[model samples]
Target chain A: MSTSEGGDSPGEAGGGPDGTGDSGGLRTTLTRTRAATALTLRRRDSLSVVTGVTVIYLLGYLWAVGDLAPGFGGYGLVLAADPLGGLLRTTSGPLSFAPVALVRAGPLAYEASLNTLVGLGLALLVGLNLGLTYLTRKQPAACGLRSSTGVLAGVPALLSGTACCGPVVLVALGLQASGVILTAFQVLLPAAVLVLVGSLVAVGRQVRPEAMAAASGSGARGSDNRE
Target chain B: MPRLTRRRTLASLASLGAAALAGCTTDANTGGGGGTVPAADDRLPLPIEPPALRDAAVSGGPGKDGIPSIDEPSFVAPAEVDFLADGDPVFGVARDGVTKAYPQSILAQHEIVNDELAGDPVSVTYCPLTGTVLGFDRGATSFGVSGRLVNDNLIMYDRATETWWPQILATAVPGPWNAEPETRSLREFRLVWTTWERWRGQHPETRVLSRDTGSPRNYARDPYGDYNPREGYYAGGAPLFPPLREDDRYGPKRVVMGARAPEGAVAFLKDGLREAGLLSGQLGDVPVLAVHDPRYDTGYVYRNPDELAYESVDEGVEGPAGITYAPDRLPLDRIHTFDAMWFAWAGFYPETDVYE
Candidate 1:
């Protein structure tokens, strides 16, 4: 699903048609990233990668945030008194939402919240980044995307999970919480998303349609990479 | 059982007048066990004004009811429980021939357990940050974690009136939900903060709170820290949030046997009470006695207005008449007391008299 290498790199060396530099390049990179991300989703292998990573990351995210945890052996479900109203209620932090329902089965229990949606969005972004990274690796010499980009972007998202419970993680580590640290926790989720999206663009802009097509003996798909 | 209506306000004003009168008496007798605090009602002295305390309430991560209360709490016998270690802390309460234990591990996850004890509704609350466990008469409505803290203590809100009541203070303060609560206090009871082994050994037939709380939580994992060995937040010198007031006389996590009344507050160092077996101090001008229970390693505070010189004997505490009495069964009027972190006690009652 990768495009062939094109010498026309967006952010690195280009100027806008009107002569704007960095902003124009960034816009072009984002445009190409959107196309590349869509292409990665359309392919079976990359789609599997996206799905697998998304599921694993979402589970890990829920576990870290304490929404999904081990339960006493049981099979039951419980809903909050006002589950609908609970959907939008904020809990531990700005982004953390209250659980509206609890679903327990066998060894695991999950508390349903708007946080699951938040985590799903983040997990999908992480999955797409890794999926693109996987494509780049398939044509190693032909691509400049580092394999570590997706992994690095995912770390902060995991840390943001602990952000739900204030300084709970800090307490476990025997670290004192300060105003600066709490402020950082409030921004961790948003920062992680921005970094993941930024990573996707950086990796996507490196793909050259002609080079990738020539390497794989297929027609060039650069123009077709657009929205 | 009355709402925060105008009539209650008038009643509170009358009570406050009586408290002021008692305060005047207390001011005259400032030395050893000498003054008298108003008789026990629900009211205890507030360190500051109610409005100031309301303004000081800060978010402790979760929102109102964010940390769910065990509204329909269930209990099991000692042999049915396997989650608690011998050294693990348990909040033990005995009332009207009924004895129960709420494990610290479970209470850490769910701060308030609304249950009935001896046919009376009560809420067993534990605050991990302040390291305090208290029991309150819930009456018709249960209490929940407001997810708010003042001076690093839990600010509980009654479900019926949505009144903000700080767990340590046991007094109502205005909050956003109910801006003009009558400033009344909740009836409080003492819960001995002792080890599971100690409580179970003392009350082998006592019922322990079941882990089958309706909420889906890993009771094994305490978000703040552990208590059996006392590590993480429980043992930390610095609190999760800044306290309302700071005192350096004792370590922040140091345990103190604290009690307060309409007149004033007093704290006896737990270590001091344990070593001396009996410590004497004055609360606002009223003399008080603290007796250590060797079995539970806990202490009870009593208003010693008669200036009784009780001594700790192998059998129990020896009163003025040389009659031996159990630590918890003293002849003097007992003041509801509980174990609290030194920081929490000092932060809530900065003017508290300390018996080191």
Candidate 2:
């Protein structure tokens, strides 16, 4: 998959363990980076997931905060049944009047701030997972499997609704705060980001290209160029 | 009831916001204490006598302060409040040379300002429903609305004690401290309910409260109605909530200069004060004076430190005893007076005497 300079110059770059068939080292790395970057941008399924969460949160947030702040007044994405009514009821604003009632309602800002943060975090976390496979195409089967599993493990955290002050609320709820949701947020976000970054490292380390093996051996009685 | 530890007690108080304290203990009501305000326990004194409280059917609405009290109130130079109409009523207070005005137009939205005036902490409060504007020296504790109302008046709670202070009664009604032996009521300043133009014109360097309160509100418009034309809510004397006691000597919401003392309570009709800047009367043997300060457009009630006034000033004749005097020329000994709607005053002070 590498269109690296090693494909042309051959000897100047380091070679892979696959002998002459290995794509050149630095060239393979650049190829991997471009592939990963492109894959991240092109993943339609992943993009839809991020976009979906954003749209849903925006619609729900607008409906819940309706007519509270001066600019935030009015229905959004009109769901006739007002699916977010339960969310709105949970809010403390007056339901009848628009702006005034919104003023009277409590926690509209708090909820909105937290909900938007959670939605965006989900978008970034999901995007990282989708970008991993193309960046680690040297062992496509293994990397793709890891990416799928990591994303599945993460989906629950995004859905848990603990994205904002959920942990504080969880602590407040004590036994009632879902332990699984708490663990997912506390552990999964970082783990997912790390896993995605680790795939890039694997590409650089394992996906070496051919040709350079015979040439620049850190030279000096070296039996093999790479340990 | 479950045993409540300090932790549990403190934890329980997390639910009440500063604004919620305004509605508590009404014809009385109830709620969550949150940390700053202790939960109302049996320890509070039963300071208010019966008839001082009545259930106001329509619970207190978050009159702009639902976002909560302005623990930190911001103020600007009097000239900054250029939008104020000359007739827009304001609650003006001058303490230790510090003169400040709280415009009804602005306060109608916020309802309470928990701030420090001079060196003493103060809470400038207004209840549009009750049509009352008053000020309190918080001592050290701040007041938050418990979101409860008694007799259509705002019930405020102290951050230290969730003890309910119904706006008109100024007495801690219920909660943990209600049964304590001594009734604790803070001294309220006599906030002159006058116009901003009149207040600023008189106190040229006075500072006016800025409407930039963090809370969201339409400061220019009054939720109850406009006071300039004296229409809408003020049009007729109608109580939003049924009073504990019904007294029709005057319309339910008639404007009056109301006062409270260790001795008793009395309300003077604004009509008499409008004509005579000074009107002296006796309630339960205590000679009092109600002086109208036209500059602030507020009527003041004073305890006649002048003992001879009862005999010297005309006692029975309505107009004869009202010695002509400027509102500013009031005697040194002054009593705290709050301008209130008759319905709220009557409801809280049912045994209160009517001074026409």
Candidate 3:
């Protein structure tokens, strides 16, 4: 959780309660990290591409599998893995960028797919958060890291984890979270999703298309490792 | 960190609200009624110390019908259930000469199978949590999960009256019939858990419940963790929720065969039956007999022939021709009996006798 929302909604956002009022620190860290990312935030190849992919993924995932539990059947998310769970499956094998819409994914299928999608989103955010923070520290002011919103942007990923992963996390923390907390963890995803969208837009705003074009064309390409 | 604080207090209060809301969600999702469901009320007439001790049901989680029940279930002949391994458990009921077997694999998901046997409408109810399979005469009505639990036992509701009936107690409580003379306990029948091979062999004409239950279900995939060898959730001592009455005389999860008489109830350890083969005992003033059928690996209770009102009719092969079974075959006048977890049986009927 970014320190921004901790005080307002303790368990709604992220991190420990003691971390409240650290938004300024979070901002300081985000700015410092965003400044170093080699991939320009708004570049046709960087944040823009990621934003487009994320948007498309969300739309397609919901379109195909959303009906299984419209608004999650008022349960937020479910994790169905029964083989008789009909069409939507996410437990085994590699996943496609988009899930195939089935006539009906049954009750269990809806739960399994939601868990998979949310779980995968969390993993990606963690990786992006770590990789971006590293670049900011390594080459300050050189890459998009200083202006990148990935760290704050990825805070919503905790909501995704909270949806299906709250119990495991809380159990690990040795905290006997109430059902309400567990439910809130999943219930708050829509709000977290909204926060995520805003962060993506902010990240996209920082992309300097011109700088990205120049870096790509000139010998400066040596300075930017695309992969 | 003092174990209580404003944040903690607010959080606890919020959680309580959530639990109540969860009950509402269960009510909404299950479509059983139009009002909010009280989370854990178990004030049934029982001998337990705490008549209704319970935990608040946490919601925003699986609600009633959230896991779903097999209301529109379909069945198959013996051939379709060829997948049954030797060790698998099945609940078999023979009535009016026609016999049917319900695999635990199927029961593991949908705990209630409302079907007719020998033309008699019955609800074959199983609660994996308590390890009980009880047959109830629906009396032309149907039963669904009330989405409530008493001592972690399945609380069921009849569609007609919407009265909540805890499966173990088998009586209506806290519903429209709360003040009624006697809690309407459903008339139970003989339901034995045995091997599929033995059930099919005893009555090869037996129709096994099918996986094609009109809904997409992993008929083979078990929702509750594996209990076949008791190496999963069944292997542990933890219970989802404790029953109101607390007793440790029998392990909470130990399987015990129980029978109730007009006077009181009694239980026999499965091992006791496995060893004794045949044991005669008295429940109330009436004498009862407990026998172990090694072929099916189950214990059966019946009224002792000496005290039986009449002789159990003998039918050569099938049963008494029509939909009624020949009571004389096993010669145990079959009564509504269940094999339940020791803790659950003892929790509800603390006055029950246990055969060592």
**DockQ winner, 2 or 3:** 3
Q: In model 1, what lDDT does residue B170 have? A: 80
Candidates ranked, most accurate by DockQ first: 1, 3, 2
User: Candidate 1 vs candidate 2: which has greater lDDT?
Assistant: 1
lDDT tens digits, residue span A158-181, model 1: 676676666666666666666688
Error of 2 at B214 (Å): 0.9
TM-score of each: 0.81, 0.52, 0.61
Candidate 1 lDDT, tens digit per residue, B170-209?
8778998878866566677889999999999999999999
Top candidate, metric lDDT: 1
Question: What digit string (tens of lDDT, one per residue) describes model 3 on residues B91-177?
Answer: 998788878888887887678887888786778898876789888777656777655567667877777557667787665555432
Specify the CAPRI tier of model 2: incorrect
Worst 10 residues of 3 chain B by lDDT: B1-10
Candidate 3 global CA lDDT score: 0.52
Q: Measured against the native two-chain assembly using Cα atoms, what DockQ does each of the candidate structures obtain, in the order listed?
A: 0.39, 0.01, 0.06
Query: Each prediction's Cα RMSD?
Result: 8.6, 18.2, 13.3
> What does the TM-score come to for chain B in model 3?
0.74
